[model samples]
Target: MSRSARAIAVNAALVLAAGLTLLPLAWMVSVSLMPTGEASRLPLRLLPSAPTLEHYRTLFTRLDVAGYAANSALLATAVTAISLVLNSMAGYAFAKLPFRGRDALFRTLLAALVIPAQVGMLPLFLMLKGMGLINTYAGVVIPGLASIFGIFLVRQYAQSIPDSLLDAARIDGAGELRIYRSFVLPACTPILTTLALFTFMGTWNDFLWPLIVLSDQDRFTLPVALANLLGEHAQDVELMMAGSVLTVAPMVVLFLALQRYYVAGVVSGSVKG
Candidate 1:
C-alpha cells in the first residue's frame, strides 16, 4: 500500500480502537444518568431518554459518599505528597550522591520489586498493627510513602541531571538540602508530576489495603465504600453506576490535566535512563 493510504488506514484503526475503549465508560455515564430501573431493562439501553442527577444526589446526600470521597482525597493526597519527597530524595541520592553501598542498596530494592507486593502485605499489616496504626489513615499512607518503582523512576530521571551543576552548587557552599531544593527538584518536576499522578491514582483506586486496615465504616475510602455500596445495592444498577462514576471521574480529570507532563516525564525518563 502507498504511504498515504497506510497512514489513513492506521488513523482509522486508532479511531476505532479509541471508540471501543471509551464505549464502556460512555455507557457507564449514560446508565448512571438513567432512571433507577432503566439500566436493568432489556436490550441494555446505551443512553438514557431523560438523564437525571437523582442517583448522584442520593449518593452524596443519603449514602455519605462525601465522607468516603473525603477520605480517599485526603489519603491519596497525603500518600502522593509524602512519596514524592521520599522517592525524589532517594532517587537523587542514588543518582548523584556517593554513599557507601548505595548501588548495592538500590539494586537490592530493584530486586525486591520482583517480589509480589501481596506477599509483604501480611507482614506489613502485622507491623502496622503493632504500631497501633490499624484502622487509621496513617496505616494506609505509610506503606505507600516509599515505593521501589517510584524510587527507580526518580533515580532514572535524576541521573539525567548534570553532575557539574550539582558540583557548582556545592562549590558555592550550597548544602545538600539547599541544592536538592533549588536544583534537583526543579530539574525533576516532570518526573515528579508523573509520580504524583501515579501515586494519587494508585492510592485513590486502592481497595484491598484500605479494606484490610480500616475496619471503621467512616474511614472507608471511595473504592472500599463503593464495594460496600455494591453489596447492599446489587440490584440498584443506576446507583452503582453513579458511584462508579464518582470513583473514576476525579482520576480521569487529574490525568487529563497532567497528560502533557505525564507523557513528557515518561518519554524523558525512558530516553535518559
Candidate 2:
C-alpha cells in the first residue's frame, strides 16, 4: 500500500475503535435524558424522542443522590490528601533514606502485594468493628489511606531525584522534615498528582467495602447508593442512568483536567526506571 493509503487505513481503524468505545457512554447520556419509561420501550432507541431532566430531578430530590455524591466527594478527597502524604514519605524513604534492613522490608512489602486484598477484608472488618469504626466514614476511608501501588509509583518517581541534592541539603543543616518539605515534595509533584487522582477515582468508585462498612443509608457513597437505587428502583431505567452519569462524571472531568500530569508522571517514571 502507498504510505498515504496506509495512514488513511490506520486512521480509519482508530476512528472506528474510538466510536465503538464511546458508543455506550453516548447511549448512557441519551438514555439519561430520555423521558420516564422511554428507555424501556420495545425498540432500542439511541436518542430520546424528547429529552427531559426529570430523571436528574428525581435523583436529586427523590433519590437523595446529591447527598450520596457529597459523601463520595468528601471521602475520596480525604483519602487522596492523606494517602499522598503517607505514601510519598514511605516511598521517598525507601528510595533515598538509608536504614537497617530497609531493602528487605521494602521487598517484603512488595511481596505482600501478591496477596489478594480480599484475604484481609474479614480481619479488617472485625478490627474496625472492635474499634467502633463500622458504619462510619472513618472505616471507609481508613483502608485506603495507603496502598501498595501508590508507594510503588512514588518510589519509582522519587528514585529520579538526585542523591547529591539531598546530601547538599543535609550538609546545609536542613532537617529531614525540612528537606522533604522544601525539596522532595516539589520534585515529586507530578507523580503525587497522578497518585492523588488515582486515589480519588478509586475511592469514589469503591462500592463493596463502603457497603459492608456503612450500614446506614445516610452514609452511603455514590456507588453504594447507586446499587441501593437499583434494588428499589429497578424499573426506573432513566433514573438509574442519571445516577450512573452522576457517579461517573466527576472522575471523567477530573481525569481530563489532570491527564497531563498523569501522563508526565508515567513517562518520567518509565525514563527513570
Candidate 3:
C-alpha cells in the first residue's frame, strides 16, 4: 500500500513482536515476586496478590546463589576473553595470511560445524579426565576457547580490511605479531565485542558441560545451580523463578550494554560477505 501505511504497519508489527517476546520475561519476574504457593493457585494469575522478596532472600541467604553467580561470571568472562584472542588470531590469519592449504583447512573446519556438539562430548570428557582437569574451572573454560562460528565471524569481518593498509605496515618492517596487535586488533573491535558478548552469554547459560565437569557444590555455575535447585525444590516454583531471574539478569544487562557493537558487527559482516 501507501508508504506511510506500510511504515505504520511495520512499527505496529514490531511492537507486537516485542510484547510477545517480553511476555514470558514479565511472567517470570511476576512469578518470582509471588508469595509461595500463590503461583500454583487456580486461574493462573500473572500478577501476584502481594509481591514479596522472600524467594529472593531465600535464594541468596540459604541457597548461596551469589557463589553460583560468581562462578558463572568468572567462567564466562574467562571463556569470553580467551575465545576472543584465539578466534580473532585464527580468523585474521585465515583472512589475510596466505598459506599452503589454508582455504582447504578453513573449509574443513567449517564443515565440522555441521556436526552436533554433543557427539564430541564423550571423547572430550575422557580427554579432560585424562588431563586431570575435571572439577576445575579450566575444564569448563578449555572447551569454549575456540569456536568455528567465532572464527568465521572474525574471518568475514577481517576480510573487509584493505590489503593495501596491511602491505604498508609490512613494508615499514613491522613484524607479523606487531601488525596484528597494533592494526588488525583495533580494526576488528566491533566484531570482537560481538564475539565477546556471544561467548559470555553462551558460557553463562551452559549447563550440561559445566555440570559434567564440576562436581563440587561451591564450584557450580548459576545454570547448574538452578538445575540443582529444581531437583531439590521442584515444588517451590517461586524460588526457582527467582533463581532463573538471577541467572538471566546478567545476560540481559550485558546484551543491552553491547547491543550497538553486536548489531554493527552483524551488519558489517553481512555487507562485507
CA lDDT of each prediction against the hidden true structure: 0.92, 0.91, 0.92
Q: Rank the candidates by lDDT, best first.
A: 3, 1, 2
Error of 2 at 84 (Å): 0.8
Higher-ranked by TM-score: 1 or 3: 1
- Over all chains combined, what TM-score does candidate 1 have? 0.93
Model 1 lDDT at residue 226: 94
Backbone clashes (count) for model 1: 0
lDDT of 1: 0.92
Pick by TM-score: 2 or 3, better one: 2
**Pairs clashing within candidate 2:** none
Worst 10 residues of 2 by lDDT: 264-273
**In order, how many clashes per candidate?**
0, 0, 0
lDDT of 2 by residue, 69-139 (tens): 99999999999999999999999999999899999998898889879888999999999999999999999
| Error at 5, model 1, angstroms | 5.5
Clashing pairs in 1: none
